[model samples]
Target chain A: MLVTCLPDVAKDVGANRILKTRAGHFHHPFGDPSRPEASERRWRLEATKKALEVLTEPVTEPTVFEY
Target chain B: MPTNKKIRVVHYVNQFFAGVGGEEKGDHPLTFREGPVGPGLLLQRLLGAEGEVAGTLFCGDNAYAADPGAEAAALDHIERLAPDLLVAGPAFNAGRYGLACARLCLAVKAGGKTAAVTGMYPENPGVSACRRQVHIVPTGDTAGGMGEALPKIVRLGLKLARGEELGPAQEEGYLPRGVRYNAFAEVPAAQRAVDMVLKKVRGEPFTSEFTFLGFDRVAPPAPLKGLKGKKIAVVTEAGMVPPGNPDRIPGSRASTHHWNKYSFGGRTELPKGSFICIHGGFNTVFVNEDPDRMLALDALKQLEREGVFEKLHEEFLSTCGNGGPVHVMKQVGQAMAKEARAAGVEGVVLPAT
Candidate 1:
């Protein structure tokens, strides 16, 4: 499984389980420099949880789980 | 080359095509005949006066599989026969037969004496095994396609024997070998670009000069039963490494050896200034400010503390994905998987940049 800002790229490459992060940009897929340190950490933790959640779901093809 | 010269051809076939018994005769040993046999007769007819099937070699699929020296033996016979061309089976979709045909053709080509060719279904396992190495004309899924397949095989085989330059896959009626050749185009590049753009704007069909090959689809492994007691690892193409970049992994187009594993033992987070991002594809400032942003090491450690999984693997694997070639990246992925599996890692979180 993988987390990427470009879910279409993941799908194109046939990644079976993907988490599409609501990232600020390619530079910071998991971090929001605009946000305060604590809030950014919280957001990162939530993203990680979503990524882990993607692993437990059954998938017949490349399926993206939005976070 | 003299037009009157007769091209000597050696035809290869499996037991079924050789009139040997089916299934049971699959264990039949290597055998040779003086003249065209079965499909070779059609091949010779197609060759007409330009070529002759000097010999036909037959082997059982099971025999080929059972003997490691099967290909060597065939090569020895082919060498002694000294045919200008070796035409292996239009094997269609028969897996074992297709593989034997493909492998033998590849060996024949590598011998640098006989030009070799084969035919099979586009989706045959043999196509993948040797398409890039040998001329494999695509055929129908079964022997029902033999009529159409043989003409193409003969055409390609004859051209190869005469040392003629082959056209593109589409024009030559063979599988794409994933090779590019330089050619003089009738149109200039700038005009062609404009023409393509105009066609797109007009919504007319226009073929692109380049074709992107389709990626191989891998079936998803079974989902983990649960994450509670699982041992997970963090991996990334975000190129996070120690501040000094000890391994000297390049900023772009990193090779297989550029990938490395760094231990996060006893560390709850990747401290700022201690690690940095080296990927050249994107801005690394944010990740450099806090390396945990790229690897999620801090969040993963928090999850570890919460028993989300039994433990976070001690080492995290990383490589610079920027401009890395697909072949090199594949090797890097395999190497990382090997290391992670050896460390008893059950799951991996790969954050891509």
Candidate 2:
């Protein structure tokens, strides 16, 4: 599974399936480790949970995880 | 040949070759000695009068991974020693050790000194990590090949130290770093391609001057329909493990065959305090504050309660993905895939960093 902030990483790494998250590829999203407000954290969490949907979709090409 | 200026060489090795214990002593910190210790002696003998083993620097495999400052510390020592050439590892198949050697070579090169490392496989993670920065000679899979590997490493080190023009990897017996140079060839490219195609058509041996790396294309399986009763799992290369990481998994560049499985059974939610991020690739403060950032464990548990899936797999697979060797990462994925399939896991959420 791809967890890159850059879409091209998924394309280059040959990951047939990809998950684009709001968070940075390394450390916290945008490199901000300070806990965001509860709502922001929830948004990030929900976005991550959407990975399950990516697994079930049938696609011949690369697809993104949209929550 | 009349002038008597011997090449001063600095050698690097893991704690194991420094006469320290094996994996048990991998936590030993960086240290330096006056001259050739352990394998350095072999290198010294081979250098004869032409080169001198100026110094030997060593570090523990696990220590290097655990300490964030290890690289800077090592660079400091090497810079102070200021040898003409730096040599690292005939590390064989030891994944962590091989990677350390490669990184050291890269560090040495960054300081404007030529460095070389040797290891067993062309695919060793260290080779891929620092190939662009250093020359890596291929060796056998075990330390038993030291006799053969050392001479080759010495030969390459001497050449690099002398600023001699080196040939391509194939001719030099080193792993190719996927770099190319423009040079006048004996034949034109169009003619070479035609000859190559002709040879291929005739089923004869042929060689391509350009080397391209191909990755496996795995089509996504049909998405799970109705998540209510399907078994799902969370896998990560983000290096999240139980507090203190009982498995002793290195934070980054996880050694070959060192993936850890954490039990998630009987827990509806993971306590933030109970888990920590050990991945050396990123800042861990936020992940430690909220494990869900990396694992989405809380969300997965909530989904389970909401009947999004039948059951979360009792175990979560984890390994450090940061700068890990390609082959070792492939092996980990393959081994885990087989295990997940056997466990009847229909879907996996791989959180990568």
Candidate 3:
């Protein structure tokens, strides 16, 4: 599973596995309806796609998403 | 039963608070002095004739944090003082000083002769790390709040020293440590609920009976080898339930401790008509259109078909993540992990909303 969160959070939590997304911790970030409809969709799809990529990568230690 | 003896109190502070040089003196070692110094003077005055400051303990924040032996040496000094109560900090926003105070409290308690108490900003890392183990009052973020904070800290310390029965954190003005026990209330639950509801309706502030303590950080386990044949499962805290909402988990502000489990044992994908999102924290429209928006069961099924993994754990653990208490969430997660391990599930993809 990919944890989509900020690098600071990844470090603060000291979690070895994370997909370091550029967002704050909490809730379905991409599911927020406050943003423009198209942008919201783009963010959701992009995050999900990134998570899938993270799922396939191999690493010996704690890894962060390149994106 | 009134004893004529005055209660002995020990006050602890950092070098800066003790009238020593600021950041530069932080490397200085621990020092012991007779009677109060700096803020301790105010605390001593607050104690009045009922209690006396037997000694003041001072250490540089850097010294305390840097020296691994500081805790033992400090405790040795405090134990020799033989004070009935230990008072540390009112540290305000100083993170290092706050942690120093917290560590001193723990060390004092370990000495076993006196009760220890301290105060710091609720947001202090010290508070998060040590709150569960000691009695800490919630103070303001800056030293400016000291006037208000010291009195509370001293008062609470006095109560503890005198062996007075203490009230809950809310009533006593300290940070809650997730401790709960049975006690009678002045009003019935129905009446209290109505009173709280009325206050909410009037837009007046009211405190809830149950408070949410923050979450704990769980470190990730070592990376697993090859996913080609590992058993994986997907879970969600987005309130996905079978179409009829069988478990009835609340859509938002769900029960702080309840987590429900659903089994999809042999299903290739979550059928379009079989599930729905009921999470009240956000708009559910996107998830309703495709339940996969939350857990991505269909995608997982596709990956499974493509042989990404040998098996998918059919059972899914779930809860409404939006507003669950941290302590309860930890317990639920622990239980879920234990069950997954027993079921031979190798990994989990937890999608949170």
Candidate 4:
């Protein structure tokens, strides 16, 4: 499948917070920013964002093998 | 100058064509008929004009496969030849034949003769089984490759006999002989090593032609059965982090990090509907759903905290499991163990896949 790269799309799907309550579907594969565990949650979101940026390129595929 | 030295070549073959017998030939014990015909003669030619087929040994595949006793006895046949170069098969994709060739080649090699084996095939189980054990020259899946096959084996065999340096396997189109070694050469190995170290000291990385396979050693945790009553702080590849892995541990080969602690009792229940799993490896949710259900944690907690022992040990540990290969697994364990030790925990229990 072809994937499109857009900087704004990643920004929109942005950071998730930790220590969330099972409040609603809105706090999905994401959580609320107010919890005590927010630091871990934000770190995860940033990492995911970086990974997505790496995977989606305009022309070629990303290098898959690592030493 | 004395140029009359001839290196002896030993040939091994299966019973069918050895002329001792046919399908029933596999029972023909190790008997030597000094001759220049049979499969052994083909190998003798490759050993050079100076080489002689000093011995021929025969054994049946059925006998070897069916009885370990017979296979063990067959080792004597190759040992008797004491050849400089040993050759076994272009077995032509035959199953029992392939195994016989493999077994004989291994025996010859173990006896310290330079053994070179050849085989054709899709089902040369012996080629693969003995591959890491000996050099099974690559050949066609059919016997037609014999002309090209045995010649290559002989060339390589002679090279080793002459004590010539061998190159990489694919470059020479030979099988990976799986011989491991260290190299020392005349610029002086010590000087060359110092040169390498100097380059590395200057922030340069050089490649070594040979690399150690991998250090997959994991010393088993001391048996926790003695602490069977303690709340043995348990862990898994379940992606357990401080809520969201602030350390940004790679979902796979995660870096080592400090463990986040959680205290549980009256108010601290990891209740259903309260926890969600972020582990990308396996569906840890199944266990987390009823954390108290997984035996080590629940049963141990019951024994230690409730009635079995004193206060159940401290916090639990965890990490994502999916796709964690050797290196990553080690790093994660190091991190988890560090935290567990800091908490004064006596022992740890880990989930097995």
Q: For each candidate, how many residue pairs have backbone atoms clashing (under 3 Å)?
A: 0, 5, 2, 4
lDDT (tens digit, per residue) of candidate 2 on B1-353: 22256888888889999998888889898988998999999999999998999898888998887785787788888778777788888788888887888777777787675555555566566766776667888888878889999888888778877777789888887777778988999988899999999999999999889876445566667767867798998888878888888888888787767787888756765657667888887778877876766776777777788887788898898888778766677788888898889989988877776
Candidate 1 residue A8 Cα shift, in angstroms, is: 1.0
Clashing pairs in 4: B26-B60, B239-B319, B239-B320, B281-B322
Q: How far is B73's C-alpha from truth in model 3 (Å)?
A: 0.4
TM-score attained by model 1 = 0.86
Model 4: residues >4 Å from true position, as ranges?
A: A1-67, B1-5, B177-353
Judged by lDDT against the true structure, how good is candidate 4?
A: 0.52
Q: Order the candidates by TM-score, highest first — what do you get?
A: 1, 3, 2, 4
Candidate number with greatest DockQ? 1
Clashing pairs in 1: none
By DockQ, is 1 or 2 better? 1
**Tens-place lDDT digits, model 1, residues B1-353:** 56568999999999899898899898888888998999888998999999999999999999998987777788888989999999999999999999999889988888899999999998788887787789899999999999999999998988999999889888999888878999999999999999999999999999877755456577898898889999999888878887789999999999989989988757888888867898888878788888877788889989989988888998889999888876678789889999999999988988887
lDDT of 2: 0.76
Better of 3 and 4 by TM-score: 3
Query: Mind listing the fnat for each candidate?
Result: 0.82, 0.49, 0.19, 0.00
Candidate 1: residue B110 Cα off by (Å): 3.3
Best by the lDDT measure: 1
Candidate 4 scores a C-alpha RMSD against the true structure in Å of: 15.5
Lowest-scoring 10 consecutive residues by lDDT in candidate 4 chain B? Answer: B212-221
Model 1 per-residue lDDT tens digits across residues A1-67: 8888888988987889998888545776777778899999999999998888888889999999988
